[model samples]
Target: MAEKGKLHIVMFPWLAFGHMIPYLELAKLIAQKGHKISLVSTPRNIDRLPKLPPNLTPSIDFVKLPLPHVGNLPENAEATIDVPFDKVKYLKIAYDGLKEPITHFLKTSSPDWVFYDFVPFWLGSIAAELNISRAFFSIFTAPILSFFGPVPVLKGTQEDRTKLEDFTVRPKWVPFETTVVFRLFEIKRVFNSFTGDDDDVPDTYRAGAGIEDCEVLVVRGCSEFEPEWLKLLEEIHGKPVIPVGQLPTTVFDGGDDDTDDAWRGMKEWLDKQVKGSVVYVAFGSEAKPSQAELTEIALGLELSGLPFFWVLRKQRGSADTELIDLPEGFEERTKDRGWVCTSWAPQLKILSHDSVGGFLTHSGWSSVVEAIQFERALILLTFLADQGLNARVLEEKKMAYSIPRNETDGSFTRNTVAESLSLVMVGEEGKVYREKVKEMRELFVGRDRQDGYVDNLLGYLRSHRRLKLEDQSNGGQRN
Candidate 1:
């Protein structure tokens, strides 16, 4: 039996690092309150996770369940970082195979609540069978979730969105004036992902079922950022919509040592630059820009002529670790003012540096949180998923400036990229965005406010916990 007033919670995020890292953050937050946490993932993914704090080791446990073999999924490709973007469908196949083991685990351990991501659509039903409370924890922002609306709307029966044009406009359910809709090119990819027929388990069904089955809806943002959106989510879902805060990584949190040779060299280079003069470029772990787009970005960086440090990644859908080729002679011309790192660099340490002023990013929520935490200027260049929506929302908020691109084909020239980079980094036109983000930073970095959200969430969990018949003898009932 669980200790009095203590909860044993199970966290099961998707295989992607973006999802896993946030789940781990929540786990740590709960564990700090003397709750027991079991974070389940594949063996390899568990190995790649950042080490838990020494104090958390006792309360938080890593539960490994080996991924089942599936054709086309590369050997040992347990996480999205391991395989290319296109092969993630195969990874999903392997992920669904975990149902048996997870079900068995739940049957044995009987955690009070299970926090899960959208990928495991069926887990909710299993949790229901065991009378375990479950929450669909979304890493996406409130704006994106509000745009997608409720399960019935996403499931597409009444007033379903059929054509690509249907998604270009603001969703009717929003009930407020907002420009949080996807762009032409972005909607095409998002629409297909939501309604694709090639896979056995459609993402639309996963998202709808995940939402429908969960007892509550939890988002990764705060009411301060988008109060209206959070209210709209509660309206549409007809349940409590909780914002668990942005879950930003603390700057003082110890990570890789700066004395390491690679970090030392980068630190020295950054030290030489003027304060707030450098643009930090990274597209995060998942969103890989294509070769053509990368070439334009390279030439654009050269044209911008600003001091930069780009943490580049492999090409989209590539299985190899080798960095993709840049435009010929591109690196040589910019070598004096720019550094491109294909290998891992300490992102938080670099972002916190004095020389770093602006971030040219793919608009991932995690990346956005990091940028907002430091009050860095944002130059948005989105490639996939909810990133475009994020870019649109940030632009609407005047918190970031996006690169100019052809609306239909999502094509951008090197000149536009260069212009955007210059404008957001050093141009006078960027003052509004710079000021707005600085204002926003107060909320993002407020550790007290962040912790309060977690505390409130824990309180809700404690009050609402439905004890099984066996557990009733030990604690009676939560209420």
Candidate 2:
């Protein structure tokens, strides 16, 4: 322990950028309170993270551990971004291989607490062996956590059996009225891709073990946004569940620099558009759509006739390289009304612009928080994990609209995309969603309230430090 009540904490997030970024944000927050934080990840991921704020350099350390070689996992493919969706399980296998190195680090460092993500279900037992208190810092929202229920449900021991039908409807635990279940297509995709093969560990088991092993469950949401769900989480888990605010990202805080010529051009275009008239479309760093899906999205934007700024993900060479090309003459037809950027366009700056009226997104929790902080309504078309759960929650709250899709096959047409875009962008029905987001913006952007959540988290960590068996008998805390 450091002098004057400061803590030495470890932060370990999953390999995905979505999970790593939030864990980084939380590390900074805790460091700001005069604690020392050691954030652990692979070498490439640490290098890819935004440069640390100057003042934070002394208080925070980035500990890089090399991922062990695993058969079939590409060389240097340390993160999910480095590989395709199908190959992610190999990344997990590689991630788990870090047990030996992480054990050496933790045993030497002997930190006060280790906060980790839902992946690495094995971490809890390791922390236990070392007698270091551990926390499961969830980057997901409360509704989804509640939907997955306590450890029993996540481990497939509940009455629901964790079957396909079980996911298509809201679980019985949520007494409040909500339509927060997966669609047929969504659940099938999850079952196929996320649930691993016989040799691979399933994601559900990971989440369960992470929750079961944690001293406290920390969520990336606030009580103001989902009080009932937060409350339900505590009851179901029979443990302390904390909400550390939304942790909203600011313009150019810790991402790629945004002052390039490309951003300047996009800014100029945004300046010329009418206020609240443009739809900013992005599906985050992950969630690559198929060629058919991408073509439909292009035609849908064209048919909607609304001004759009799309940040399309560049396709990798081996993954459908041939079909990756855009529809012929697409740029020629939509040149006047749309601009598609293949490179990174600072998302915070774009969403903060006056012209960006709505976000057409995959409903990733971080993206949704960023958009709401700027009062931009959502137009959801979820394609990957937990996004459908977020879309359903927002849809139930009447604060967003989802593009219609076939229930069984989960296929959506251009017409449905156009219609959903129109409804959320400029149609009469979109007014409710627009106003609702504006009203909820305070919950996301209120810095003071957010700071309070972090302070409370620190207080809990301090009070509940891993006490030695002798100290516990005398009610003494370790630090």
Candidate 3:
């Protein structure tokens, strides 16, 4: 290596909090191993760094890049969570412009390795050209990686399988009893439209889209969660599928005094509640429900009569006016039993708390992982992306239950919402799910005497580096 000083690493993540958060944790872990890390993102996001943990701030260097202006994008829309969906075009253009600066930075800095997310498909070839080893860091689980990677489908070779009636047709290569929905084809088409060229889609996207390729896959897994999927991924990839597990306490590190106070107050309120008695509801940053849906949800929560905490975003779009009304005196009616918080909350801390019996989530992979990590029983109400698939997997595994949606549009009705809330929060079914959740929590969180996921990850990283060094030295001798 470089005179036994420190290994330099560069990390580039897609401009989204869900993607950036995990990569940030990995970077911190690398830094702790005596490596220098440079994390590159837009200037707007870079400005938010001061609000993060001191350890994350000290261990990593931040590179602020300008967001190239494209038509229709707002001036201040650079932060991962702030960017709207329609401005994805501008983001692609901005990212494309970044390639040159990234190349120059690599040439000057000469990092030993580059860790990148799926959005920058071209980075692999660039890293190879610059003689830097590259690793793909997937924030998803192993089954997700395996499902989206170059695995053969049972439905035979076809470009678009939507025309086929039975979407549940398993692939020839997949050993498990699996089924695919026709809607997945529609999702692929949408993603392909945005990326411009089909060739540029990452291997995972391609595999999910029915294209095949040979590439290394990395996932976030541990011995306790989905071990079978991890084993299957290794078998399919024919390469080491490293499971770094969950990195320790980083996401909740930031926030001002006011924010901290709010979190503490919420925690105190939760602590007073009995175990498995509360329902936690949050739709991640990207998901904004319609006014009608939001009203329905509010009414449903009120009808459930369970102790609940709901996080509501302040702004609804121009077309949606439902949240503003709130059924006239609805807030007062539910004041004693329920709480509604505006803006941000410490999500990870809330999820891990004892009183949170069930999570009513949008089923984002990051949220799913967090829920699993905390071993909370779930009431899955998926909205978009692979979230539907995640919900299906959880239901199939009997780990969580899905809220029944409208047959025509797959949207949740108020009745369905109320029913699901009652089933997960206070009904007989809730008790059974709670026991299963407790067992899973014990498995993942581990016992008082044993080391949990974080320790296993640290051990894995050390062994991985040693093996890499051995391989490099052996190859040099051969040369």
Candidate 4:
């Protein structure tokens, strides 16, 4: 060890871009406090990580671990993007193989703490072996976990939760008024996407183990937005839960939109529109829309007759599917008022643009935080799992309007999509939502507030420096 006062932390997030980026952000933030961060991941995922600041580069090290090749898993397919949705659990199986390599690194590195993702529930044992403490870096917000609840619910230890429809209704622990649960069709879509059916072998069981085994639950949450949800987590897990404010709340204006070629075209498009007039649409890297859904979304934008910036993604396995899904002559007709992009756009930069006033999102937690951070009014198009619950939270908080889809089956029409987009972007109902977005943006993701949460977390880590191997009996306890 270099010194007694310094902290050495190892971070390992799940392979998904959504999960990994947050862990990277948190690692960067923690490094700024003069702590060393050993961020571990497969080489492919590490390459995909967002750029880290030059000043923090020396303190944050990438601990590359090779992904083991498994049968049926495509060569070099180490992340969620590399495989179809059904093959994700195989990625998880490959991830579990890292325990041995990671444990070896921990043995040599002697890091004080390990901050882990939901999938590596076994890390607790590894940390314990190294006389190191571990915290689960929950990229999902408190509400998602609070609503997903404990082992009994997740493992279907109880009879009711085993079925798909059971989760459509609120979990018993959640407040019905603000409860955010999956829809029935959403439930079917989620379970069907997964390859496994046994609750004992599902990802939930693995995720909950980390929560139960960790010293504490560190979440990307802030009291200003989800105090009740935070409390619910504490009650359910009976462990210390720290809301490390929706992170990366730095005072950043993004690259010079006017000068940078990366954003030049997008900036030019926005400049052509009035301030607070464009709806920035993205559904994340995952959540590829089907042909029918893509058509509806495309026609929805056509029907809305508003300025928009839509990021269209090609469906996996087919390279030209983006062009195939668009309604005939749709792009040509909407060219003046809308822009369709097939590649990745700098999401935060687009959200921060003056002309971008609203967002049409999948309501994934990362997307949710990004929208709220920029004070963008939301038109939620929640597609799966926690996203449905996340949409409900925004609706209950009045922070955004959840699009009304078919109640029994989650199918939505182009008209409703147009109506929801119009309402969030230009209609009278959107006005109040925009106003609330501003208030929440200031309260939840304010730069100073997020900075303070990092400081608090660092302080918590420093307090654990004196912990020794003999404290095994109290390993799960958090201060």
Q: Which whole-number lDDT from 0 to 100 does residue 415 have in model 2? A: 96
Per-candidate Cα lDDT values, in order, are 0.86, 0.86, 0.64, 0.79
- Per-prediction CA RMSD (Å): 2.6, 2.3, 4.7, 3.2
Instruction: Name model 3 segments beyond 4 Å from true.
Output: 1-6, 49-58, 151-169, 179-215, 235-238, 248-256, 264-275, 314-328, 352-354, 372-375, 442-479
Tens-place lDDT per residue, model 4, 342-388, is 87687887888999989999988788778888888888887765788
Residue 69, candidate 2: Cα error in Å is 1.8
Task: Please estimate how well model 1 matches the true structure, expressed as its whole-model Cα lDDT.
Answer: 0.86
lDDT of 1 by residue, 406-447 (tens): 999888999999999888887899888888888998687688
- The residue ranges of model 1 lying beyond 4 angstroms of the native Cα positions read 250-259, 316-323, 466-479
User: Which pairs of residues collide in model 4?
Assistant: none
Pitting candidate 3 against candidate 4, the one with the higher lDDT is 4
Let me know the TM-score candidate 3 reaches against the reference structure: 0.81
lDDT value for candidate 3? 0.64
Deviation from native of the Cα of residue 356 in model 1, angstroms: 0.3
lDDT of 1 at 111: 90
Off by over 4 Å in 4: 156-160, 192-195, 198-200, 249-262, 317-324, 467-479
